[model samples]
Target: MDNLATTWVGATAKQISRAVRRGDTTATQVVADHLEQIAISDPALTAFRVVRGGEAIVEAEKVDDQEDLANLPLAGVPVAVKENTAVAGLPTWHGSAAARTAVAEEDHEVVRRLRGAGAVVVGVTRMPEMGLWATTDGADGPTRNPWSLDRTPGGSSGGSAAAVAAGLVPIAQGNDGLGSIRIPAACCGLVGLKPGRDVIPCDLGVDNWLGLAENGILATTVADAALGFSVLAGRSPAKLTPPDRLRVGVALRSPVQGVRADEPNRDAVATAAKLLGQAGHDTVTAEPPYTTGVRIAGLLTWFAAAYREAQASGLDLKTLQPRTRRHVRLGKMAWNRGWVRQEQRDAWRAKSLAFFEEKNIDVLLTPALATTPPPADGHSGGSWRHNLIENIRYAPYAGPWNIAGLPAIVVPIGLRPDGLPVGVQFVGKPDSELLLLSIAGVLEVANPWTRHAFV
Candidate 1:
């Protein structure tokens, strides 16, 4: 229908679903439009490990064939699943060939929920091997940021973020263990939400990184993010309401001892504070209690997660990338010493929750990242020390929240001096996912950033 919108490539999930449900366009056309966009653009970003072109079209046709679309929340919208997750009939490519698993007989629970909500899985996006590093790259190639090709789309959810930033998909599914989803969202100028622990079922590899990881959504808009979150969490889609006046705690301190937010990231926090103030929310300078013990426990758990996944998958550690192999070895040592304990994480969770009550705040605000994203090149082949240093220096702000198992979101504030996107993180008490989304929506309306990268 040339009379209709020329293309649905950049449409939000809500817009696309409404159009398809209203008979303005067919699901097949929408899926075809997105597939064409992916074919034209994904080669540059290397965002996907697989594109289900034929299968996606067939699924879209099935959606159109259904007699009633009244109950579908994401009717006809295209989505990308992170490569680490299972999609039926496709081998799970855990970032590289060496880490690839056999074809999944059935979809993961999250994928099943998305399909049930009428979303089509167009492809599975790439990640770092075993999702060990913050930067996304592998033997195939690096997943570059859509904002700047030279800079990284921070990972291990990098590919998912890139696809959404470039409008290949309106929303992509990602899981955050140690800031995987939020880091990429920050780098690519999107809204990324990591729900509090166990809010959504996370049957990810070998115990979901010892319960630090949770399945989440990354999207160009807060409404789409909330829609995706609802689908994954198996709840009815709810409209996001503007939140009541909140007492927000603003902190510029980096969780890592040696790393601090660069000037651009700090400015991003300041910008967010001003927006909150303009929205009738109070802001105060308050820092979460990120103690030395919490930092050490989080690092050990991160290393142990690598070891657990590799061992449980029966992967030959020597065949993995050099940096990953070193990480696995350290994980084994940590496991042997019993350093990665549940009690340590639980302690941090208790302390983090107390900070809100002790300070009399409803939400906590912090820079999404410590500095700009690292370079996209050569990280997959770099030495273990270099990769570790680069990752920690730029992304030290996200892991502590994961350790605490609190709901956190990253919302883009503005662009950096060097033209990369910058964002700020908001952490709320348990069961505050919707509250976090409401705040993000306020930011989106108050300071509307570019919806898509000008790729």
Candidate 2:
């Protein structure tokens, strides 16, 4: 690999793709350099579960052999897929030993689209078992934040977030059932977007219940997130320009009643709202539409889905993590209630839409998390009840958007006195992704975030 090509580690997905298309660097070189970076950096970070160097080299060779690379928007960009998502020839290791070790027969729909865009999949990142928690720790180990190793990267997309934040890959794909993508991004200080329901196919290759989760991208910049999102969503990746003056509503409240956001996180929301006001957008305080009961129902549905996955995987119950097994027990009990069904999920989505329409707000601004990432070892190996309370307290702001099925993006505002990044989220109604992207694009330029951590 060319020594200078190692710099590709800092390049955005768009920059890398353009360079590869223009022949400034070969796809193989880009992939090799990224793999090398992973070799050097990932052991300390514990971000990726597997690195597909051979498979990625073969794919990069195919891209190099192509005569017209212009059609491929992501011509040579390296991406990390969350381990929970199906990637052909790789185990969909849902961060649990109980998850089957069989390699996926085919790529998930979003992964397939990414390949069609000429992007190279370097590896699979880690997550919590069955992706049921906020911090990224499982049978493997905990994924530490690049900013502060003692801090968590956030989960269930913690590995993806850590990889992107540490500059291991320009972009990493993640999924959000109840704030998995956004929470990790917030912790890592990257742009993480969860597109509204049906805006991106969520159940392409996996059997998902609740339909609460959707695939998304974690990137250093808004443009990179938009680029990867376009490729994964099968749309033409275009520039995200400034949006019109939006009516932005700010909510500092937590989704759960007893969970109050810490001072720093509340200040993050206030700071973000002030920035929007300075940018000429109308800003006002607003609370999330759904009630605590609705959120509870959604939480139960998510737990029930986790239980079903554990049961279907056929792994011996003894092999499962204790916390996971407890979740399974609770989920089974919740499933008995008959409320974690499609109709109820749709009703929650409808309520969210109605709230947005009635408020006449173009976007909603809220804290990305209740606190910065908790201690790396804070919740690891704890009892299920302890994990439950800690996870809820750590991420009080993120789950409601998933419950609402709205497009929500987390952007880094700045950092806490302790040096960890603080992110605030901007949420839009269903199918309002473009608007949210445009707004994020504008904010990104105004308050540019440092792309690289101290290496």
Candidate number achieving the greatest TM-score relative to the actual structure:
1
Clashing pairs in 2: none
Each model's lDDT comes to 0.93, 0.84
Model 1 lDDT vs. the true structure? Answer: 0.93
Which runs of model 1 end up more than 4 angstroms from their true locations? 1-6
lDDT tens digits, residues 38-113, model 1? Answer: 8778878999999999999999999999999989999999999999999999999989999999999999999999
Best by lDDT: 1
Candidate 2's residue-wise lDDT over 88-120, tens digit each? 987788887567568889998889988899899
Q: Which 10 successive residues of model 2 have the least lDDT summed?
A: 1-10
Task: Report backbone clashes per prediction.
Answer: 0, 0
